[model samples]
Target: MDPRSEELAALNALGMLESDEKRVLDGSSLVDRELRDLNAELELVAAELGRLVVPVEPPADMKRRIRAKIRSRGGSKLRSISPLALIAGVGWAAAVALALASIWLWRERASLNQQFNSLREAIAPVTQPTAEKEEKEKPPARNLEEELKKLRGDFESQKTALNTEIEALRKREADANAKVAQLVQEAQAQKERDAAMKLHVATLQSEIWEYRRSVMTIVWDASKDQGALMLDKMPRVESGRDYQLWIIDPQKPDPVSGGVLAVDDKGTAKTTFKSTEDVGDAVKFIVSVEKKGGVPKKEGEVVLKEP
Candidate 1:
């Protein structure tokens, strides 16, 4: 019999009561026949509304704009807002807007019902005959059936327009979701590329070697097991010979063959190579002139050597 019980009953009718609250209300058995009837009527109205209403999606940039606004405010205000809280606020705002639209629609429907009743009242007296003389003199009464048919056609047209709008909104929502997924994939790929570059940069070692008329510069990264060689002003080799690079690791008796190299007519050559064998503790690098195809051993004259 408490006043709060009636308020709780309304919330239950709206399907918004928590499980524990519903259990308590059910156990109390204080809700009278009048309250139960009100709850049932409200539930029926809600069911009818669910059928009439279409699902609506919030604007694609709604969250983005809200976050941007928060960022622009700056300082303690921005720090105070958490992402989850911001998202929840946006959802609450959307719900409020949707509720307002439904209320407006219901009001319009009620107004139309009132107009229909007035129209029926205006036409009722015509059906009940006054004096036969007055009836004949009043001229042919307007066709009420034709008027009702026109109203029904207008209602159908409005319904079709609303359905088309709903379909368009659904398609836009799908497209927005696809675009967000593509952006996420691209971001992940970029992050991987950045990590590789950083690792290569971190492991890099460079040394300059000078001998007689030629100077050779070497840049290598042990993590990649690869390096680049640059020779300046070195005399061209014999017709059947080519330059080869060797990576010497103290752990191995034989130096690893780094690829063969060819220099341009200007006596300047630059080429990159990957060691065939592990060069993790490489102590020295040597460039040798050998037969067109390089040899596994140091079987050629040393053109350059690095400490």
Candidate 2:
């Protein structure tokens, strides 16, 4: 007859009592015969009510309607839950689990009791604190961080795209610069190839015994004082001596050094030379045997002179 005992008896009859709560009611019934009779009576009444009510066929869209109603009433979804929200959802974990257990019980024992479904439906609107809804209800700072993260992702992707474009442009610019340099070099080379040459020729005779059979020819350029010298049957210089050529101008007293010469064993040598000083209108070319490494002045024996 206790109010709490009656409440537990009613909940037990409708299968709404949790396992621990059901155990407590069962233990109380053992000591109190009135509570035991009341529980039995409540169970019989539930069964009779189930049998009396004829099953009503549900509408085709009943499930959709019920789901919409649940959502409007703040039902929470459980899919794709984040770790932090899952941890925060611990409070309602038991409620969701109990809802599942109630689902199994309703399927198995649905025939025995129909009115109990009303009780389950009545409590359905209560415990819906799933992580999804919890996230929505979070503070403004959490929302701000999510916005900032999205902005940062967009900025990084744009930066990478811009860098790729810049690199491509740089490569194109480098290619253009290289092509211009190549064209300039080709133009310079062509200019040099188009220039003309003016040369003068003279063959010198030597009267010295060692140079009698030796033949030396000078191909000179009067304007540049630069030309090639050819020698045949020439005698090799003595030890510690080198053979040097010279250019002479009718106006100047001193001769200009032409350069040194090296001869082969067959007494033949050919080389190009440029005078150390300008020799305008060169009238003479000479060869001298000098100390090793030719001197700046004509300080050696003149073996051959130009006619």
Candidate 3:
């Protein structure tokens, strides 16, 4: 016999099955001998319980007392009675019925109570552990102060990092601004130097000297010890030779070497030269061909001379 069939047999015997379940149990009981036997035993037990549950009616005098109690509680008629009044009437009727049943079953009441207590004690161990486990699984409460302190520490760490990043950016911006300022200063100084050179060239052009095959122009600023040179129609030098300029100063015994000069493809050259020594009393200028790097002494043939 299947366990489900046995359960259905028990329900059917006690008259607790729905109409559909009752139909299924009746059909199964015809073929299942164990289910049929179990159903028969359950029916016998239910019949015995039905016999033990005696139908006790309230006496006439008890009914009159209940009506008097309801009237005193402001319920004049049954039709006008509230649900509470109806519940009170039912409770009183149940009490009277229970009193009569107890009187009739007084001999069995002690045995039944003893059996009920024994059953509760037997089931206590299984139920007690489950209640204790549920209590243990519940989460403990959090401390508000500790949680707030952790949040504040995290916020302070983030704020410090942010402030450090901001300071680094400020330093980088300051360095960039300083570099831009330096470039601006250098550009302004370059512009002033160019203007001074142009002015000096104009002054030298006013006092120019011309030679037989080439023209010479000199612009000397004794205060700064610098000058500009301009030569036109000058012959190009050999591969290992270069043209050099000499400044003849009355105070110096030897002519001071000005600098080396090179002619372009057009046989014209323009350059600025500065002397290491003072040339405050220069009286004449000369050009000579020398080696690629000019010599301190004029050891080459003079090509152009200026008064």
Candidate 4:
């Protein structure tokens, strides 16, 4: 049957048996199958509905907000214009203003320059000073020592902070390296585990394939002893219940006796047929529980079959 038709039939059957789940089950099947068309139809419906939903006016306070912004800018522009006007004053007035400004600026510049010179002089070599010059500079030397001490303290504090930051960065780098190593180890282990699991699964699949290819259920031919079958592990049979082997024979009154066989956990069994037995038309071979020898009766389902 077509997969789609089978699926639809199952859904219809379920819906008929349980009416309540009908819409829940089938309501969105077509929609899911034609998602693009559904989305387009939804968009069209939304657009049509949007036309009926009129937009309300913006809040009245927004106009007030705009007007307030304009007024604020107007005030700012007026302030900015005052500086321009001062710059564009009459040339005579500007000259006089400039002259005063230069004098004041010069005074300030002279003061700053003097301060800088004094600082440089204090930091420079202290030559053998004359008595009066030495007396004049003694106070400044004391102040300079205090300034140098303050600068040194600041430098030491910054150096300590920088050292602390460097140590923290080193620790972070070490931790990152350690974490990377751990992840690498984990990844390697995971790869090994995955490889082992794949091998185990492949082995199981191969064994199953071999089991599927076998034709005969059981065989008992000692003449061609296919090497002594290894008896790795023996199954625990019940008391007085030994595994019996038999062969179907048309010439004989019934299936002929083969020999006792043993089964192991690996599903392997072995038995040898009697050499003198004609072994004619042995259409079937089987194992069963009976006396401590072969049995002529079957008391269990056929676990294996021969073509």
Please name the candidate that would achieve the greatest TM-score relative to the true structure: 2
Which 10 consecutive residues of model 4 have the lowest summed lDDT? 198-207
lDDT tens string, model 2, 132-205?
Answer: 64554454346445655665576567556655655665566677678889999998997664333345555665
Worst 10 residues of 2 by lDDT: 108-117
Give the whole-model CA lDDT for all candidates, comma-separated: 0.63, 0.71, 0.64, 0.47
RMSD of 2: 46.8
- Cα error, residue 156 of model 1, in Å, equals 55
Ranking of predictions according to TM-score: 2, 1, 3, 4
Top candidate on lDDT is 2
Q: Which prediction has more favorable TM-score, 2 or 3?
A: 2
Q: In model 1, which residue pairs have backbone atoms overlapping below 3 Å?
A: none
Candidate 4 residue 30 C-alpha distance from true site, Å: 31
Instruction: Please write out the lDDT profile of model 3 over residues 178-286, one tens digit for every residue.
Output: 8889999999998787556432211011122333445555655555667766666565678999988887778889888888987898666778888757876434677
- Judged by whole-model lDDT over C-alpha atoms, candidate 2 comes out at 0.71
Q: Which residue segments of model 2 deviate by more than 4 Å? A: 1-196
lDDT of 1: 0.63
Per-model clash counts, in order, read 0, 0, 0, 0
Q: What TM-score, over all chains together, does every model reach?
A: 0.33, 0.36, 0.32, 0.26
Of 1 and 3, the candidate ranking higher by TM-score: 1
